[model samples]
Target: MKRRWLLSLMAGLALMAAASAQAADPVRIGFAISKTGLFAAGTGSQFDTYNFWKDQVNARGGLDVKGVKRPIEFVWYDDQSDPGKAVQIYEKLITSDKVDLLLAPWGTPAHIAVSGVVERYKFPMVGDSAASVKLRELKPGNLWFTTAVMPDRFGPVIADALKANGLKTVAVLTPQLPFALEVKSFLMPALKKNDIEVKVNEEYPPSIKDMTSLLINVKNANPDAVLVFSYPADSTLYMKQARENGIAAPFQFVMVGATESWFTKQFGAATDGIVTMGHWSPKVAAWKKAQPFFDAYEKQFHEAPDYLDSALAYMSCEILEQAVAKAGLDKDGIRKEISTETFETINGPVKFNGVENATTPASLLQIQGKSMELIWPPSIATAKFEKKPAWPAN
Candidate 1:
């Protein structure tokens, strides 16, 4: 009887040990992201931020999922910034590589392409960059969530700023991409409704390099404000060309440049008074939670964080980590948790609205001195709006 009892005790211990070992196994997350091609510069910092999060989590002994600490592993592929390739790679990540969790790629087009696949597989995904209204219209199920503030929210802010500053007329330039088009769709009507005339509403090809003619045309129109909706490269080019062509407007806004550190670094005093939509800045009191993240990111990466991309990437990971912890290893549970819960991230408390979009206010940032300052939305404004932007000497 004693021998039999001892064997039973030993068997129980063995079972417990096996369960512990299984719980300790690494949790694999996968995604395809742009490492090259058109989306490269835009996605580069975002990708690095993800790596930074991974290193931080692992350094702390990995993610804690339902009381057990599981080492986190990422399986990623370069999508080369192509939507078609992103879709293909995401399919493989879900079916072939069998990643435990999935993350959305860099932009609206890529996210829109992969949304169906994520829904089909019922894999929960968090998008860091995509903000097109089309995503909401698609209603791509509850499994997908986006951190980017929708265009509708940002459009009104810009319109209000224009109205406040007494800018009577504006010229708008946008890339032909869905994201830019969506923003333009909202912004044009908003400007018109605010009694602001849109002198030149032009859409350009994404690959267009010669914007001199376009700038000259806009210069001739002589609008009070000039808004360029493009990515970093094109935005920078437009600003340089605008300066070179001596196209000075009372207000100049670019959708992409002011939020990036490199934009200021490259343009220096030239970036002064340039307005852009931004996600986060260290200056806002609401962003106090992000200071540690900024410090850690700078320490790890040897550069200041790009608020637009890096902040979004880090916040997405934070949400995923929380969801995984609360929901355990089950994909469906994580999806439900994320949909229902309000996640506390560096950007403050983020809760998904009915459409699986994170409800966060967008900030209008302007370059003042060498740093970007939040100027709109009084609740978080770090500085008053400069009525007339002080243009640099050509």
Candidate 2:
């Protein structure tokens, strides 16, 4: 009788231990990012931020899941900024690694390619740099979400800025990509609505090495302002050439230049007064918690954080954490929670419209003196624009 009682007690203890261990298993998150290729800077910054979040969470005893803190395990794969490759890597993440959550890769081309796969897996993902409006055109599902400021949100704001600034004729240079197309679609309409004339419009291939000819042509056309759509490298080159060749346009800005700090660093004095459309800036009190984040990031990486990538990564994780806490760890439950969800983030308040598949009340910013300043929508403008950049300078 005594032996039997001891055996029964041991069995009960063992069962409870197993249950605890199972509950404490790490939650796996999957990331497909550009380890190499054209968009590496953006994706690389994103990975750095993600790792920072992972470290911070784990250091705090991991995530609190039903009274248990489980460490998060991220399974990352290099997408190489190739869409087909991104699709393949995503498949491995879903089938082999079996990640509990998904993250969008960098660059528009890769995102456009792998979005279908993410949708198929029914996973919620927010990318650091994939901000095209086309992502919302697909069928709305419970597991699909993004936090980046879509171009449509900024296009109208820019058009209004142009009209207000008395700039009527503008030259536009766009990259041949989905994001550029989406931006142009909104900007053209908004410019028309504001009665601003597009004097010179051109789209160049992604591989174009030299833009001297285009600059010369634009100089000849002599538009009031020049707006170029480009990534960091292209942006740096364009500015350097524009200055050296004496394009001397009082106004020049690149839509995506705001994402990387290198834009200002590379351009230095030339970048002193460039205007840009950005979602977040460190100067804003709205992201008060972000100062510690920025400090820690610089200490670890010996580099200042890319506000665009870091903020997006942090907000993305915040949304995932909220959804999981609300709906438990089950995939289906999290999916449902994300669909009807609305939340505030570091970049002000955000919500998926559930209709047009886009975000609203996105902030527009300009680089004034040495800092990014908010300039639009009145509700969130911390600082007004003093002097906007211009092209075709006298």
Candidate 3:
């Protein structure tokens, strides 16, 4: 009886040991994003892209930490596009949930708010969306790395396009966001240098629904070009109002909404000849693998991916994955590695310049026949520019 009892006790101990050995913790990544709110349209695409990356990584047995493969898990919250809410959620992610790593929230305002919390926690975070020159000014100690193109770079590109197209005058309408404002700031000098006269510059609140007066004023100014720098919804509203008010310049350069499939579908052929910024297209040869990424995204999402959001999401994860592999899961190690190394991603080689900014080249694309065609940077242009017809009578 004694011998049998001892054997059973030994078996129990062995089983417990085996169970302990088998229970490995997953690598948890956390962030707050706009599931619903003003930023929802863009964040929705970003969320989908992050999920797609997560699935792809987990399918391959997750991230390689040192030499062992651990499954990846995400702990996220909906910030509802509020910076205050995002800050609160990020604090919880750091202290209570205790995520293994962190990803930046959706836009510049949210990111700016959450950045303080990240700094305190010293988590290595990759920012996918936010790109204000202010981020560099903050000098956040390399804890944060940005994936999106900086506004400073965007101005010169747009100026070049304006000069190339023989546009001598422009009117600017921008949302009063840090990134948009920075873009405008950078653009003004370039515009002046390029001999383009600014006829009218207007700032609108993001929540402003009616742009009738703004469009009317712009139409009256009758500049050779009109530049609209706003988010998707505002850009859409502006375009709708511009069309309704018969406000068509020889060159209309809108920052957002123009590249989106939904935007094109909503306006139909009316979207033709309207130029906007594009980060990646299948036609871009910088990353030969861009076509494959585009195909995979469409197959996974059942729609064309938003170029900026999709590229930022995929490349941000890719950089994080690479940094982890090299740095062995230590936050400080990852931060140092990311700050110092240039990551090769689907967006091509991303090397951080001074002020923690990385150069992701921008191209101007025009809609032609319900399709986005790269028209600027003739070296990489997929299609030539098509002159816009006069706005249809309201």
Best by TM-score: 1
Q: Compared with the true structure, what per-residue lDDT tens digits does model 1 show for residues 1-394?
A: 9999999999999999899786667888898889899878778787888888888989999888977887888999999989999999989998999888876688878988888888788787888787877767655444454454588877877888888878899999998888778778888888889999989988899887889989988999999999998887798788788888887887888886557667777877888788887767776677667888888888887778887878888888998999988898798788788888888888888888755555667668777766667787777778877743555785
lDDT, candidates in the order shown: 0.81, 0.70, 0.81
lDDT for each residue of candidate 3 in 352-378, tens digit (9 for 90 to 100): 665354566666778777667778778
Identify the superior model by lDDT, candidate 1 or candidate 2.
Answer: 1
Per-residue accuracy of model 2 over 208-271 as CA lDDT, tens digit each: 6889988888888877667887776577678778876776555566766565666667665566
- Write down the lDDT that model 2 would get: 0.70
Instruction: Please state the error at residue 363 of candidate 1 in Å.
Output: 2.7
Lowest summed-lDDT stretch of 10 residues in model 3?
Answer: 140-149
Model 2 residue 58 distance off true place after TM-score fit, in angstroms: 1.3
After aligning candidate 1 to the native by TM-score, how far in Å is the CA of 105 from where it should be? 0.6
Candidate 1 to truth, TM: 0.90
